[model samples]
Target: MRAAKRRTSREVRTGNRFAVLRAMYALGTPTRQELAGATGLSFATIATMVTELLAVGVVTEASREDSGGGRPRSRLKVAAGRGLLVGVDATETYVHVDVFDLAMTRLVHHDHAVGEGTSDPDRMVGEIAEGVRSALAAAPDGDVLGVGVSLPGQVEPDSGVSLFAPGWGWKDVAAQALLEERLDLPVHVDNPLKATTVAELWFGHGRRVAHLVTVNLGTGIGAGIALDGQLVRGATNNAGEWGHTTLVMDGRPCRCGRDGCLEAYIGVPGLMAQFGERHPGHRYLEGGSQTHFLAAVREGLEADEPEAHELVELFGEQLGVGLANLINMVNPNLVVLTSWAARDLGRWLLPVAEARMRREAINGSAAVVDIVTSAVPTNPVSTGMAAFVLEGFLERVGLPSPTSAPLRRLAEA
Candidate 1:
């Protein structure tokens, strides 16, 4: 009989694999010796791990490079196309689903309009499941490694549950487990802002920064923080609750039953409320056809409507005030503005917002931090969800587990 294989400590195996994956991701394409050096692992150990990775088709070897005084060295890179991950974003008005490879390249995307005030969680999840299935069917010879769902609420990733989603009327819903049961794959769940932050950290402006804040202004305003290169999911997985932060006490009421919350002033409804108050006859739908409103604003510029300009300026100032508070608290190296508002109002409103931020932010912090718009412009939520799923796949398949200590040690080494 074959000797029973002894199992190693889960922590050790996880740590070692994570180290190797980190080195691979950082180096892009590295030789065995280079990867060993980068990961602080012995050359022999790295060689064994690389061999296993190649066997599993998670990584591939490239053409050898010849050195002046030694044998040729073989380069290794992630086999991006070997597997795919599915991501779904279920919002109040729309449901978006996308499929991406391990390399985080989008393969297919699908979107559908969801009726407003449809707070039935089961029905919404079913619709999302259908969309994800459709997206997967469109993919070419790709096997799904995992699924990630991004929503507008507090999520507990470990439990695969949405603790609360006021908009969806969901409480403690096992979103990930439900998706996994339907799709027959591992699932990861996160808030839209957190997902967007992950996407930013990997491929957007946050890539080069150690600490960053991503503020998403859309149907609602929310934030995600990456402090010292780690995504800060608080004890309850609701760390960056900037939306609920009171900007004005006893002001406008928010959906979360709070008065004068930041979301009440900067969210889509707030903008439309301001528009309606100013232009009583103008019919604009909140969170619907924002392009129409933006067009109207452009036309107003041509017609020189003072009210339109004033509303835009006011929106900028309010946004700036909230951002200034965040800047003072986090003191991030970078701050990214995401969602439809940022895309539409960024150029016109950024200067105003920046001016306010400069006025309120701590001395020199304003100058040190780079406040910019999100690079992933089209369907950021969908892209972010895809990135989140890909990261989970990476972790599941012994690529890398995202942890602060290991990453810090690797950087130092």
Candidate 2:
């Protein structure tokens, strides 16, 4: 009974420490008094916890500011560089790696191109490993705790295997194990879109939104849905596979071997194909340069090509129509758009898409749904993957969760 009581006491103390740390971090640079107030802890408790954290270099004094015209109070923030995190983005065009500190700041990033339609899973994993090595070498410090990878395919959360990445022509590949063997570090893998959503929930708009959907429009379309502040990976861990949702019955064939899928219409190739059908005699999409296709379309429109504007409207309308179904069904507070189509052409696509969504949604769900581009800038997917590993490392130190056991092991070492 005495031992039980002691264990309970330790647990409570640990919980309180975590609560104080989270409050301090969320406030960015909160004073001891602010942390006490935010965490509902007594001043003495906050003082004790802060001192312990500061002594160990977990939290640092960021600045000093006068409080209410009185003596300057010390401002505290998380020590961003306490541990190193590595992230790999197994994308279609390139296998990108990003290194970050505990505070989710990218220290260095590099890209290694992989030829499109590379079917050999071993080759793909090798490229990702190379990127990881490059990132690790570039880090200011060499104490990398863990690795997180974002694949453009379905990844099983439990086993961390790449279920499928059509672009890579991979299926049921042991990506996590492959990476672990190469880097000898903890690894967490997930779909790129889902990884981005996880990052947003922890650091970006997630502070305000309890329910949100981030639609990634790249080689294929997929959504990362967070409902009630939890990233929902459905029964099969493919809950937000919005790209393959049916758009037009028996229309165009999609790369996923489906007819009239949304991805078939608005995917990089699909959009280019749609433009070609509308305008004809266009020498584009030949070399898989989606950027060139977009530039040409934009150029034609800039030169007052009515057909170009019409093509833009059609693309936006189709995308909006698809999103309207999602808004009506999910009733999300916000819809974040990513990828070149949504990122570069968002200003033009958003308005038109929102208008169409509002007009098409069954109820007034669209009226309340805010459509915007992702708040996370440049390499959002890779950055998010880095956050995945970094958060794991931080959580073991009583910061945030859900913690990665392997990451905890590496951090301890």
For all candidates in order, the CA lDDT equals: 0.77, 0.75
lDDT of 1 by residue, 32-98 (tens): 9887776667888788778867876878986689876798889988888889877787887778888
How close to the true structure is residue 336 of candidate 1, measured as C-alpha lDDT? 92
lDDT of 2 at 98: 82
lDDT of 2 by residue, 340-401 (tens): 66766676678888889888987668667888888875577877787667556655565544
Q: Model 1 misses residue 137 by how many Å?
A: 2.1
Off by over 4 Å in 2: 1-26, 32-57, 60-74, 299-304, 394-400, 403-413
Best model per lDDT: 1
Error of 1 at 325 (Å): 0.4
Count of clashing residue pairs in every prediction: 0, 0
Alpha-carbon shift of residue 385 in model 1 (angstroms): 2.8
| RMSD, one per candidate, in order | 5.7, 6.9
Pairs with backbone N, CA or C atoms under 3 Å apart (clashes), candidate 1: none
Question: In model 2, what lDDT does residue 122 have?
Answer: 76
